[model samples]
Target: MFGIEINNIQTDKLFDVDRALENLPFLLEGVPYTLLLAVTGMLIGLVLGFFLALARGSERRWLRWPARFYISFMRGTPILVYLFVLYFGLPIAGIKLTATAAAVIGFGTNSAAYIAEINRASLNSVSSGQWESARALGFTYWQTIRRIITPQSTRIAIPPLGNVFLDLLKATSLAAMISVPEILNKAQIAAGRTVDSMTMYITAALIYWPLTMLFSALQDYLEKRYNRYL
Candidate 1:
């Protein structure tokens, strides 16, 4: 050993509960922006993901290929890198987006790729027999999907969709990189002021834990409710 002594090392305080508690108000103020980013991004993802799922399922080579390529590219890229590119790259291409706009777009676009796969899996889980049955009943292909496949697939999709929602919520923290002022950004500011990095980050975790727990509880309830008949 190189003369380094563990016994003589000093560790910073891990928790200053009172200081963390005092910073709660300032930190919580960012919660609305965080929630807004998550909610709005999810809504965008849901709409685009549904179409992407359908396109991937389409018989046409053109539609399916584009959807496949989109999913592949988005899945291959990290969300933070995607955000940085969209935020910084677009301006150079003669398009500009505000930090909030870029955050939502980046999160939604990346989320759509995963959501598309989730929806596609749910759609495929429905029995093929039902598609045949609908055809025998003289339903058009679109009609069969709309009336028979979509409803059941929606129930199947709810649980996984909830996980995606929670992930998007956590991902909102990355928005701070673009100056969106979400929760982690506030915590960083507090840490800088107090010079207590450990305590401030622990406070952020405490804040996120309950929110995630509540989302998990809601996801369970919906999954059970949707599957009650089975």
Candidate 2:
């Protein structure tokens, strides 16, 4: 028999697993609000984006120009700047919303600009004859868009829209600045009080990591489902 001596090496509590576990509940408690903001904002943006996309694709100069300008302005600005303007600046003009509400609106509006472009490109990918075919079948323009164009465009648009939702979810962390008390805010409070920055952040990352993975899986599933229709 060969004999060997082994000695144990002790590690510091700098990355305390117990501390992370203790802080996780508090940090994760705010995840519901974070999901709410992301889902509601993305839904609002999706609806607004579709209308804007159609308007942008219109032949009329009046309609098309305004849509172009809106896309240009929203895409040109940073989301954090948009949040500041909506949450703080609008109060000066006698219009005000709660920090959470304002964050949702700001994020949604900014997202719509990007969503609009993606939707428009998807819409364009379909042949113009598809529209003419729908019209010849006695379908109204709205009906045609709702029933035909939308279904096809959805296949093209889902991937990018999923990207937008992921972007929105991450951006909700910015709401911490306005005291919306989302995931990051809760984690910050935990870090401040515990003086355990590394532990608290690791806990928050663990909390959010699952949510990101869930969305990613859902996106892949949806893309596959839609791709079959294509």
Candidate 3:
């Protein structure tokens, strides 16, 4: 094995910092795939989640029962367990999907359960009187929801939804378990080759930390904007 020249290494440079900086490009390379998974999962979950939230709030027993059941099932199960089943068991049932696709579907479905509950709670937080007033003004149920409920619920839900997005970003790391070459996956490869576990992980954190901070700042800005109306 070729020995590293310790004397050639700059005494002024911290080994960890220097190694982490050198591995920056490898970590940065995983950014796109991480964002891709997070965005895809969040977007798909948003639509399904809103519908499930609406269903959870429905007066109709038919809609309510199924929505409630779905939420209960998903919320009761761990996301990793859910993904394992989907990734491993589903193919046995003829539902074949690639690892990346499975990760997207799995995360989206799990997040939808939580998102539905968050929106439902936000919907409940809106005053019943608001709905009554809308109905008195000859608004249909849909019109009342569209005009009054949704706007208020959206304002209330933003912080929680943003928090969910942040969670989704972190959760994308799990994609590596299923062979998705996300940030952690690439970091692992680099670490294996370089035998520098500390440096590789540090590099990954450098990447993840800034991305988390960026979303956190956006969440704060939106929360403040909504708070102004309050």
lDDT top scorer: 1
RMSD of each: 2.5, 7.2, 5.9
Provide TM-scores for the models.
0.93, 0.91, 0.89
Residues 25-61 of candidate 3: C-alpha lDDT, one tens digit per residue: 8778889989988989999889899999999989999
Candidate 3, which segments miss by more than 4 Å at Cα? 1-15
Clashes of each: 0, 0, 0
Q: What is the lDDT for 138 in model 3?
A: 99
lDDT of each: 0.91, 0.89, 0.88
- In the range 1-230, model 1's lDDT, one tens digit per residue, is 67955565445466888999999999998888898899899999999999999999999999999999999999998899989898898999998999999999999888999999999999999999999999999999889889999889989899889999998998899998888988999999999999998888889888888888988999999988988967
- Sliding window of 10 residues with minimal summed lDDT for model 3: 6-15
What would the per-residue lDDT of candidate 2 be over residues 1-230, giving only the tens digit for each residue?
A: 79987667445644788888888888988898899889989988998999999999999999999999999999998888888888889999999999989988988888999999999999999899999999999999899999999899888898988988888898899988888889999999999999988778778877778898899999999999989865
